[model samples]
Each structure stands twice: as structure tokens, then as C-alpha cells.
Target chain A: MTDISQSAAVPGTAPQRPAATLSARLARWLPRLVMAPSFLVVLIGVYLFIAWTLWISLSSSAMLPRYDFVGLEQYVRLWNTPRWHTAVINLFLFTGLFLAVTIALGLLMAILLDQNIRAEGVLRTVYLYPMALSFIVTGTAWKWVLNPELGVEKVVQSWGWDTFAFDWITRPETAIYCVVIAAVWQSTGFAMAIFLAGLRGIDSSIIKAAQIEGASLPRIYASIIVPLLRPAFLSVIVLLSYISIKSFDLVLALTNAGPGGSTEMPSTFMFAYTFQRNQMGVGAASAIMMLMTVAAIIIPYLYSELREDTHGH
Target chain B: MATLDINRVRKAYGNLEVLKEVNISVGDGEFLVLLGPSGCGKSTLLNIIAGLEDITGGEVLIGNRVVNDLPPKDRDIAMVFQSYALYPTMTVRQNIEFGMKIRGIPAEERAKATNAAAEMLQMTGLLDRKPSQLSGGQRQRVAMGRAIVRHPDLFLFDEPLSNLDAKLRVDMRTEIKRLHQRLGTTIVYVTHDQIEAMTLATKVAVMKGGVVQHFGPPQEVYDRPANTYVARFVGSPAMNIIPGWLLASDGVPTVAFDTPQGEAVVRGVPLSAETAHRFAGRDVLVGIRPEHFGLDPSGTVPVGVDVVEPTGPDTLIVFAAGGTEVVARLEPFDAQVGRQERFSVKAEKVVLFDPATETRLD
Candidate 1:
């Protein structure tokens, strides 16, 4: 009887050992298995494409992508083009104005909404409604409104203000400003939402304390409240910079790089060169330059933010 | 320093009245504490005095000036918030000097005042650090330093020590008391902590449900609480209120109650002659502090000890007495559980209250 029982137990224990090890192995591999598809997709779709673009920027790839090494010739050509110069300068101008006006107007709106006001929810929704629309939609809607004969100028003239002259879109020197206006209108509400969240996170007693300290309301906001919103300001700037760089759709729909190419941006210039003008080499070079500019701004921010997280601060 | 007077101040939010004609007065350099549980309108009253909230009715006077229409800045008061609301982006030095700078004081004077306040708070080393760099107690000191630099006529503290850890809270309490002694500024402080009120206030206003239940010196509020609510709310291991009969025979007032061991009577309960005569043979609530019960072998009351909790300073023994469980705070090892022990009530300290009104009998 003892011999029979021992024999049966040995087979049972042998099978159980392998089954346990198999299940443990499956458990360890399951998460990686589930994540592998997305990981591979991103690796190929983003990083691989970036590397290909870098290679093409360094090569003499024209309309057909001929892979012949032509070390910086496309870059030289890109710099010499006056249209590219206009695109670059326009980018800087649009980015600066868009950031400044959007932040100022957004912060103002957030502060006004924070005064324990009635109907705040409805007002907030009204301000934020534009952000839900696509930039193309915003651009098209603004295009109609900015047209001198069809929109604001005509309406004002119809209302008997015949010399209103609100036609910046028609002037080459001021056309970029019109793009800046449309872009600011599209993004200011997003910045306001971020600022509102940051404002809500503050200890309300600080304002009360400042009030008791004999500081005027404007002084309190300028010195104490705004200074405390440094992190919020950094977040807003980074997000707005990202938005300004990739603002191809809005510019395309609103100005289409029109009025002597005054409102042309890097993104628009790159698209016109590569796809329309058959200068893919110069387009690739411009794309690389745009990437470098963004990296210059974002890398340092990401490094500091990640370092703060690691230090548990 | 200045006197603060709130006369018939009423605060209402639409139809819900938070403060109902509340009145309080504090003399120059006096520390007054508004003590109550949350939603008791103590903090609201403090805000009304600070001009941080609008008064639905009545008047608030500071230094004999009616500040009904004055903003908080013109009220000539400085406040310390419970969260120690130091400007997070500013250094301690800058925070202390900000008010002076806003008032357009000379730079030299601002620096001098900042340095003096920092040194007085013993945080000179921390003057260059932002609020996030400091610990809770250090932040509290910085908040006080900011208030101190103003040198306002009055100070308001809205539960300033409620955020600290237990040990740090005790330490900061002492620090605040020391500052008050050194500065001698009239202060109106709000807190839900009875111990804080007892230790720090010259006068304490114990509030409940928007009414001032008792307003007097700390000892008076402790010894002679105005009502049963004040009695129960003012003490830890709150005063035991047992139901019993007030027997007045031959002009001597005694209390009679039923215990598990049978009848128990406490003789010579001190009361006014009229109160004793009128409440004779009527139901009354006997208010007895935990420490008033003593272990005596020949005492009249017998209680069956149910639980023994030996704290470091004294042991708390819960027993069945007067048809309810009563806790007696006594020296450690005074009695054992599951034993019948006789305890005596301190006659003079014992108080009687009418059962219906819950008010002290004389």
C-alpha cells in the first residue's frame, strides 16, 4: 500500500511543478505582450520616420527622393530663398504675439471669473467653446469675419461708419498680424482653462491676507498672485509654443500664405516646397530646422520637470 | 493695541442665519478666544471683526471707531490664517517686508523691520528660504513674523495651530502665547480646541449653533458653565451629567439617584436657598467633573467597576452609577475592574441643573 501511494504522489508532484512554472511564466509575459503592439507601432511610425527625414535632409532628394549625399547644399538653398526667410521671420512674429496676447487675455479672463461671480459656469463654457472646434473650422470662420467687403468692415460701414478701414488681411505688411489674431482667438480659451485651474489650487487665505496688508487689488495680483503662478506660466508657454509651431491648418485655411507670401510659416513653406513646388530637399531641410527649434525650447523644460519628479519634490 | 467690540452682529446667508445678534467685547491687549465646533459661527464672527465679511446687521468698532464700511486694509488689523498663507514664491524676508513696501515705507526701514521680526521669531537663518522649504512650525513662525512687522492695532488668528502635529502644536501654542505677552496686542482668535482656549485666552466665548453659550474668563467657564452645552463642550472626558432627584429637607440640599448596587445619595449639594427650595423633590441633572469623584471606603455611592484605563497621569475607571456609565479620573491603581468600589462626590464642586431647561440651578 505504501509503495503504490508513493508512486502516485511522485507523478502528481511532477506535473504540478511544471504547471506552476508555466502559469508563472505566462503571468510575467502577459503585460509585455499586451504592450508590444503599441510599442512597435510608435517605434516604426515616429522614430523611424524622424530618422528618415534626417537622412533626406542631408541628401539631395528632390521630387523623387534621390538618395545622393549632398551635405548641406539643400540647407544653403533653403537659407538663400527669400520666401523661406519670410516664413521664418513670420513664424517668430506669430509665435511671440500669439503667446503674449493669449496669456494676457487668458489670465485676465480667469481672474475676472474667479471673483465668486454669478453664472460663472455658463460664462466659462462660453469662453471655452472655441477650443472644442478644429483649427481649420476656426480659421474658416475667422476668414469670413476678417474679409473687408464681407465681414466686420462691411458691417461697420453698413452701420454708417463708412471709413472703418479694418482690413489688415488685405495688406502684405500686416497680413501676419491677421493670422496672429485668428490663432490667438483659437487658443486663448485653452490657456484660460489652465490658468483657472492653477488659480483654484491656491490657498484663498493668501488673497485675504494680502488684502489686509493694505495692498491694492492690482498690486496684489501683480506682486503675489502672478508670481506664484510661475509653474502655470511655464506650462502655458510650452503648450502654446507647440501649438504655434504646428499651426499649418489655421494658416492654410485663413491666409494660404497669401498677400505676397507675408503670412507664410515654416510648416506652410515646407509643404509648398515639397509637395507643390517639387523642392523636397529644401522642404526636408526646413523640417529639420523646425525640429531643432522645438527641441531647443522643450528639451530643457522636460529635463527640469523630470528631475524634479525624480527628486520627489 | 486697541479694543474690539462687536455689538449685536448678525450674519446670514439668504435665509440661514449663521450668527444671530452675537455680541463680544475685549479690552486693550486682551486675548479673546471664540471657541466652538465647526459650523458654529465662531470663525464668521472673527471675520466680521476683521472686516473680511459683511455684517448683515449691527456694528463692529475697533479702538472706538465704527468700522462698518471699512475694508479689511483700513481696519488696522493683521491676521494669521490656519494654513500659514505665506507667499510661496517670496523669501521669508520679502514676505515680512511686503506690507511695508506696499505702504511705501523707505527701503532702509523695511529692511530693519524685517530683520528685527526675523530675529525675534528666531528664524534669521531661514530668511532667504521660500515657504515651501520650511517645515510647518517654521511656516507658522514666518506667518506670525509677517503679521508682527505690520504692528497693527489688532491681530486676528483663525485657528492658526490647527494644522500642526500634536507635539509641534503644543510648542507653537507656547510660542504664540510668548509673542502675545511680548507684543501686548489685542487679539481675537478662533479655534475648536478647548485646551487652547483654556490655556491662552483671557476671556473665552464658547459658542454653539450661532449663540454664545458662555462668555467669561477661562476658569469661570470651566467651573461655572452657563449651560449644559458649555459644560460638556469645555472639558475633556466631558463633565458627567447624571439624572437624579434634588431633595431639600431642613434647608440642606442633597441629590438622590439609583445605582446598580441600590440607592445612593450625595449630601450637601451647594445651591441657592431659593433654587434648593423650588427644586425640592424634582428631577435635576447633577453635573460632576471626572476628578470630583474620589475613592473612599466609607463613601455613600457604590459603583461596579466595568473598565479600567490607566493613562500616564491618572487612571480612568468607568462604572455604572446613577443609572448610567460614569467615568472617574483617579490616581493610577485606585480601583480594579469587576469589583464594587465606593466613591465620594466633592459636595461643593457638584452642581445641579433643572432637567427641563438644562440650565444651572443658581
Candidate 2:
């Protein structure tokens, strides 16, 4: 017979041991049995997927996955390419313009709506309808309005002003501004929605306190209302940045990197190289670089913001 | 610094009338408390005076100027809200200095005023802390300090102490009373708690259902209430009101009620001859405060005790009297649950009201 103390003895109690217990074995294995599946899935699915992408970025495979390592050649070649460089520049330009214009216009619209206006429901619907539309629809509509030879230029010339030239969409130097205008048109409604929520959450008592403190309406908004809205500002900035980074469909339909690749963004660049050019190694490397760039800029700011949110002022 | 005259003011929100023909004139340097339950339009009246809410039809005179059209900033007043309403992101110093800075006060004076207000509130150590970092009581102090530093003509408070814990509320009440004594500023404060109103206000306005039922000194409002509502709303645990009939046949004027304490007669009131002649045998409400009830077994009015609650200093005896529920404050030694007891109502303190109008008959 097996010794009973081997399985069930309390190690620190005394010399005499109890008999082996079924409960002890069940207790040790219960938690592991419950947790093992989820842990294995995270390890094999998510972690391995990212690891495989990273490995592919470091290799020289095309179309399908292969294992011939090239040791940083893909990254070096990526930096030297003009299209990749132009995509990086356009990303910055689009993000900057998108953030500034959206927030400014959103704040204005939010303030106007807060004034106990009539037809408030109708006004909010009109301002917020753009967010409900798909990017494909938004891009198609703007492509018509922004087409230099067909849309605005044709209409203006018919008005008998031969000197009037609305040709920004056809010019290399000015095509990026067209993209920004359409981008703002598509997303300013979202900014307005966020800011409306934030402004509504402010206490009316504070507005009263400011007025009693001898603050005019302009001063009150500048000093008290805006300062209290920093969290809202940070949230809008992060959200608008995320949208600007993967901005593909609008660029593809409206500009198609026209006027000599002036509007090619990172998402468009990644799609072109991977599917059209069939350079999977270079595409994966570009995707990895974009991910790293976003993480490097956003993670630290989000870390501090979340910590402050949980820990408080 | 200023006298606020609210002359015959009425407020109506589309057809739901809120304040009905209210009028009051607050003298210079007086602390006036508007005491009422929620939905009584006390806060709405306060906001009207601050120029934050428009009165349907009335005139507001601050000092000598009619300020109905002036905005809140131009009204020369400061208000402390129940929520503190401090700018959550600004430091305490910045919050106190905000109004002064906007008014274009020089930096030196702004600093001096902030320091003086902070020192007075005992918040010197917390001047650098944001409002979110302060405890509830400390935040209350900061809110008050924000008002005091402005040196405005009038100060308004909207239930400023209701958010604090009980002990802290009492402490802040005393602090506010002392601050009023020191500052000597004209104030209009609103509160639902009668005790706070009594302790803080030089004059108390008791409101009900959007009308001022009574406005007088605290003792006058308590001792000689205008009507049944004033008598009941101005006291803690309220005055016991019993239904009875006014007897005017004999030379003496008295009220008669059949109580479990047996037949009780309250005398010694000089009734108006008009009321006496009109209500010869009409029903009336007899009001008596709890402290006036005595627990003498051989007294003229006899009652049976139901429950005795000891509250450290005084004991409360809930007894059946005059065919209605009556609570009497008795000495701890004189109260026992389920005991045979007799209670006497102080005859002079008995108040009579016409049952139909709920108005004082005297």
C-alpha cells in the first residue's frame, strides 16, 4: 500500500500524518484547469500572430510567408523609398489639420447648441449626420465636388468668370489641402458630439459662480469652461489621431495619390505594396513601422492620462 | 454694504406659477435666511435676485438701482453653491483670485486679498491644492473663501452646508455665523433645515408652496407663527396640531378637545372679536409645542405614554393625546414606555387656527 503521508500530510504540523485526501489533488488542479485554455489562446493566437508579422518584416519573402532572413535590409530600403517618405509626410499633415480644424469648429457648434436654442433636435441632427455615413459615400460625394476639371471649375466658368480658377485638386502643391477639407467634413461631426457631451456635463452652478465673480461670458468660457474641459480635449485629440492614421478609403477614391503621389498615406502605401506590387516583406515592414510610430507617440500620453483618471487631481 | 429690496415679485414658468407675489427688503449687513422644503421656489427666488433667472413680474432694487436687466456679473454679488462649484482644475489660490484678476485688479492686491481670505478660512496650507484634492469640508471652506475674497455688495448661499456630514455641518454652521458677525455683509441664504436657519439668520422667511408664509425674527416666527404651516414648518419634529372647537359662550375664551388625556381646556387667549363672533362653534386647530407638555400624573390633562426615546440630553415621549399623535419632550426621569401619564399644555402657548382656511384665528 502507498504511504498515506506522501500525498496528504500537513508538512509543518507534526510527525504523525493523516491519510491521503482526494480534495487536495482536486484543489491544486482546479484553478489551472479553469485558466489554461484562455492563457494558451492568448499565447498562441495574439502573441504568435504579432511575432510572425515581426519575423516576416525582418525577412525578404514575397506574397507568401518564407524564412530567408535579410537582417534590416527591408527597413533600410523602406526609408530610402520616395513613396514611403511621402506617405510619412502626408500622415503628419493630415493629422495636424484634422485635429486643429475639427476641434475649433466642434467647440463653436457645441457652444451654439448649448444656448437653449429652438429646433435643437433638428440642429443636432444636421450637424451630426456626417458621422453616420460610410466613408465610401463621403469619399464619393467629395470626389465629385472637388474634381477640378468637372465639378467646381466647370460650374464657376459657366457663371461667366473666365478668370476664376478652382484648380487646387489638380495641383501637386495644393492637393493635400483638399484631402484635409474632406477629412474635416467627414469627422467634425464626431468632435462636436464629444464636445457636446463634455459641455453638458459641466455644472450650471459653476457658470453662475463665474458670473457672480464678475466674469463676462467670453471670460468665463476662456478661463473656467475650457480649463475644466482638458480631459475632453485629450480624448478628442486621441480619437481624431487614430482616424487620421488609417485614413485610406477617402484617399483612395478622392485623390488616388494624384498630382504625383502628393496624397498617399501610410494605409494606402501598405495596401499598394502588399496586394498590388506583391512585396509582402516591404509591406509588412511598413505596417510595423506605422504601428511602432503610433505606439511610441500615444502610449506614454495615454498612460499618464489613465493614471490621472484613476488616481485623480 | 447694500440693501436688497425685492418688491412684489412673482415668478411663473409658462403657466406653472412658482413664486406668488413675494416681497421682502433686506437691510444693510443683515443675514436673511429663506427656509423651506424643496419645490418651494426658494432657490428660484435666490436666482432671480442674482439675475440668473428672470422674474415674471416684479422689481429688484439693490442699493438704489433697479437691476432686472443687469447681468449677474454686473449685479455686484457673490454666491456660494451647495456643490461648492469650484473650478476643479484651478488651485485654491487661483480660484479665489479669479474674479479679482478678471476685474483688472493689480497682481499685488490680488495676492494680498487671496492671502487674507485664505488666512481667515484657515486654508493657508491648502492654497496650492486643487479642489479635487480637498476633502468635502475643506472644499466647502474653499467655496466660501472664494465668495468672501470678492468683497461684493451681497453674498448669497444656496444650501451651502447640506452636503457635509452631520458633525461637519454643525461646525460649518457655527463658522458661517461667526463669519457673518465679522464681515457684517448683507447676505441672503437659503436652507431647508430650520435649525440652521434659526441659528444663522437675523431674519427668517418661512416659505411654502412658492409663497412667503411668514417673515420675521427667528423667535417671532417661532413664537407667533402666522398660520398652521409656519407653526409646523419652523420647529423640529414639528408642533403637535390637534383638531378642536372654539367655545365662545362664556366670559372666558378657550379651546376644547377630547383627548386620551381626557377632556382638556386651553385658556388665556384674547381672541379677536371678529373671529370670536364668526367662529362661534366652528372647528379649529390647536397648536402646542412639545416642550410645553408636562408629565405630571395628577395634572389637569391626562395622557397614556406609548414610546419613550432618550436622546442624551432630553427624552421624547410619544403619547396619544387629544385624539391625535402628540410628542412631548420630558426629563429622562419622567418618561417610561407603556406607563400611565398625564400631560398639561401650557394654556398661554396654545395657538388657535380656523380649520377651513388653515389661518390663525386670533
Candidate 3:
């Protein structure tokens, strides 16, 4: 310790120390200095805004910021509104169906493409093409495709199937299902890419050993391969949940929560109350509710994942 | 246990042929090692025998039944891979009983077989542990346990010990040999390590360039290699191939080669009468093993020692003979470099090969 302190003290009194220490200090502070702007921007933009929203959720702010506190009243009003109830129900329905169908279709495609198929690059590109577009683009494209007069119904009727009536997007009860279909189509390829990477990470000789052990292809995949893809499943679920909760642009471009406001989600509902309906306090409460739901699911997953990492697994 | 017969097997991918008309036969309960360097078609042949790869133009018989169109599961064979290939998610017991479960065997029978295999491999305490939790040697034992629980007609091992460290490889090699002796099942093992082939194999097939060069007992293959490639491949500090002339002196067949000191002749070479007669006064290649040279002050061959290396048990002296470097493993002797010495060659142990064809003359 004395030797280290001596060397450290010598550098301060040396004749050529100014030039050397200037370079050394520059080297030490350069990375932090370069990162400071973005760090400060995120500190204000994301975290400060979150704190502000939480405080506003406890206050009675309608058209502007108000400091007068009203504890839990906005939450009470948020739960009592019928449209908020519909939005909550629709959110759960969309999240559950979106998760199930995307995972199933994605894993199926990844497994099928893993069979040493021909033109696999072309097929993978085609499947992943939807993820390259913005949610607005996908929503608009799927809106036209689900439209009865312009898309599938008209195409089928042009082929002389005139008695067919395909109009799910026009009905309030079935409009959410249409939104679910469009969202699944947009993100299933992303899930497949992740699953494909996981599948490729497995040792090929395990499959060979399973084959030699008299396990059929499907049995091997179901029993051995799927269980090994737990990490991939976690990743897909977390990312898709985030997408489902923040589903604002897609709803606007596709259904606009129309046909009796049946397909309203928390994101669209939050936007309408804060900007259009002048109920900022209730809007902040709903946003906090969404944040809590996300935290509830993600905290345990992150805890386990980080605990595994620290244990050197 | 059953005999394995690979009859005229050939493997080709498009225009590139990897295995060319290979033929080998293993008796029941015999340990046959297919030994070769990388890309030498040994593993390909083993895969063909396991029905993992298709035979281009030949038949493979297990227990005298031709299984050309059978899948790997239909063939009653179990294989242990070099990577161990254990199911990472499953416990050791589950891995061992997977085959039995797929075959619809009873739970009691599966558990009994799994316990028996684990006990035999001395891994009873590891039955509930995942493969990721086991060490390399333990994982290898689990792989072997999985293979043996099936009680198949044959066992195939694809360089199973190559992934192990040297000391662990030897231990696992001994374990495999003990397993073979207790089971008495036909085994076809493929490896590139000559020592493993020498220690554990009942018969060895040394291959190169997709062709089997020599096939016999390990002792026979080592004593009388069929070609120059086999001579250089199967031994450490490989056999010396010296240019020499084959001729007879006083009705005794002899080999004469030039040394750095002088010309030397090794008499009484044990060649057949036909070989002696056919190769008289012709140039030939002489193969002498490093251990076949004995130091003698009054010996016939004079060598100028260039370098000396004393291993623990034997001293290796590198010398110039027949215009090429030669190594002779000798007993610990006080030999100085850059000094002229005389050494006697074992005449009967000397092998002669044809220079044109590179095959043994006799």
C-alpha cells in the first residue's frame, strides 16, 4: 500500500507530470463524457416523465398540470368507466391469443425450415418481411386485406363465390379477433428468428442420438428439442407482451377502436383520455396500471435470469 | 452378439467418392477398430454400418441380415459419439431409459435396466443429476451407460475418447475395454489414435485415402505392415524407410544400403523364395522399426550419430543411414553425438517393399 501510494504521489510532483496526467485523465473521462448527453436525455425523457405521470395520477389534472392532490380518485374513475373495462378485457384477450398463435406458428416454421430445405434463404426472407415494416404499415395493409369490399371477400366473390360473407372487421364483437390476427402476422417471424437461433444452438448429434434411440422426429422435437428452447420461449413472450401493451398505432390504422369502440386497448384508451377527452389524471392512472402489469410479469423473469447468470450457469 | 460384415461398401456424394469398395468382417464379440487419419472414411464406414449414411453400391449385414433399406432405429445397434451427445435437459436415469421408453418397455423393466447400467458404470449416485452437472469423464460414462442399456446386437463407438484429456482418455479406454469383456458384444470402434487401436482392438483396419490399407490383428499389422503408408501411420516416431538393394550373397537373401560412414548389408532377411528370386539385384525400400536396432561395437552397419534423446526407458539416437535420417531406440548407452557407431539389425524383423508400387515385397 505504501509503494502504491508513493508511485501515485510521485506522478503529481514530477516535472513532466502535467502532460502525462492530462492524457491519462482524458483517457479516463473520455468515454463517460461522450456518453453523458444520451444518459441525461434518457434521465429526463423516460424516468422524469414516468415520475411526473405517477404524481399526476394522484392529482386532479384535466386540461393542464394541477398540483392539487386527490388520492386514488382517478384510479377509481378509471376502473368504473365501461370503455376502460372493455379495453382491459380486450388487452388480455389480445395478449393471450397473440402469444399462443405466434409461438406455435413461429416454432412450427422454424422446425420446418430446419429440415435442410431448398431455397431456405428465400422462404425465411418472405416470412420475416412483415417485421421490417412499421406497425402502421402492417395495420394499413392488413386493414385492406380484411376489408370486405376490397380484399379477401371481394377476391373470393370475383371467383363466383358470391354467397360468402366475410366481414369480421365490421363487427364490434369480432373486430378484436381481426386485430389479433394482424398482430400475430406482424410479429410471428421475429419469434421464428429467435427460435431458429435457439434450435441451431443445439448439438446436431443429439438429434442423431435420438434417432438411433428409436424416437420419431416429432417425438424427439416435442420431448427433447422443445424443452431445451426455454430461454427462447422467455425472450419471445417478454418481447411480444411489450408489443401487445404498446399497441397504439396498429389499432388506429386498422380498426381505430371502432364498431362501438369494442377493440379499444389500454394504449389507445390512454391516448384518448389524455389528449382528446381531457382526462389526463385518469389517463396517467391507466398508464400506471399498464406499467404495473408489465412489472408484475417481467420482474420474476428478470430475477431468475439474473440469478442464473450470477451463479455462473 | 452378432458378426458384422461390410461387403464391398462404397460411399459417394455427387461426384466425390469418400469410401471406395471397402470390405471388412468382424466376428462375434470381437473388438474391431477402424483406425485412420481424418477424412480417411473410417467414420463414414461406421456410419454406414449404423445405417446413418447410405451405402452407394454395397450391402451391410448385421447378424447375417442385410439391412440396406433400414433406418438407424431398425438396426439393433447402439452408438457412443465422441461428443458424448447426452441430452442436456434430462437426468442420467432419464437419458438411459429414453430408448426403453420409446420402445414401450415396462416402467419396472426400464428402471431395472437403468439402475443396472448406472451400477455397472459406477455412476449410481449420478442418476438424478443433469448431464450439465457432470464432469467430462462422468458424461462419457453416462453415454456408455445409455448405449449399453439397450443390449443391442452390436455397439458402435465413434472416436469416443478423443474429447478427453490424455490421462482420462486412458482411464475411459480401460473402462470401455472392461465393458466389452463383460458384455461380450460385437463392437466396431473408429479412432485415429494408434495406441488406443493397439491397446483395445482385437483386430485393426488401418485406412488411408478411403481405402483399407491393412486389416489383421494389431500385432500382425505392426510387425508386417502391408504398405509404406501403414508403416508410417501406425507407429510413434514412425518406421524408417531407407533406399536399399535386395540381392543374395552365398544363398542368403540380403539387403544392402549406403550409410553415411560406409556401405552396410543386413543378411538373412526372411523373404520368401519367390520374393528373393523376383527382386534379385533390384532397388527396394527397407523398413526398420526404431526398436529393432541393437548397439554393438562389432556390428555390421556403421552409422554416424547426429542427435541423441534419452527418454526415461530408452535412448533414441538419430543417425544418417542410406542418405536419410533414421531413429534407433536403444537401451541407455553412453553414446556421443558426431561419433561413429556400429549397430546390429534384426534380420528377420526387417521388411522389404517395392519402390514402384510401395507394397510389401512379401
What Cα-based lDDT does every candidate model obtain? 0.91, 0.86, 0.94
Order the candidates by TM-score, highest first.
3, 1, 2
Q: Candidate 1 - CAPRI tier?
A: high
**lDDT score for residue B313 of model 1:** 95
User: What RMSD does model 1 have?
Assistant: 3.6
iRMSD (1 decimal) for each model: 0.6, 0.9, 0.6
Candidate 1, residues A46-101: lDDT per residue as tens digits? 88988888888889888868887999999999999999999999999999999999
Query: Highest DockQ, which number?
Result: 3
TM-score of the A-chain for all models: 0.93, 0.82, 0.95
Q: What's model 3's TM-score?
A: 0.97
For residues B1-362, what per-residue lDDT tens digits would candidate 1 score against the true structure?
99988899899999999999888898999999999999999999988888889999999999999998999999899999999989998999889998999889999999999999988999999999999999999999999999999999999999999999999999999999999999999999999999999999999999989989889999999988888899999888998888899876887789988889877788988898888888889999989999998888898888889999988899998987677778889888756779998889898898787889898888
DockQ of 2: 0.73
In the predicted model 3, the residue pairs found to clash are none
Which residue pairs in model 1 clash with each other?
Answer: none
Alpha-carbon deviation at A153 in model 2, angstroms: 3.5
Candidate 3 local lDDT, residue A253:
93
Steric clash count of candidate 1: 0
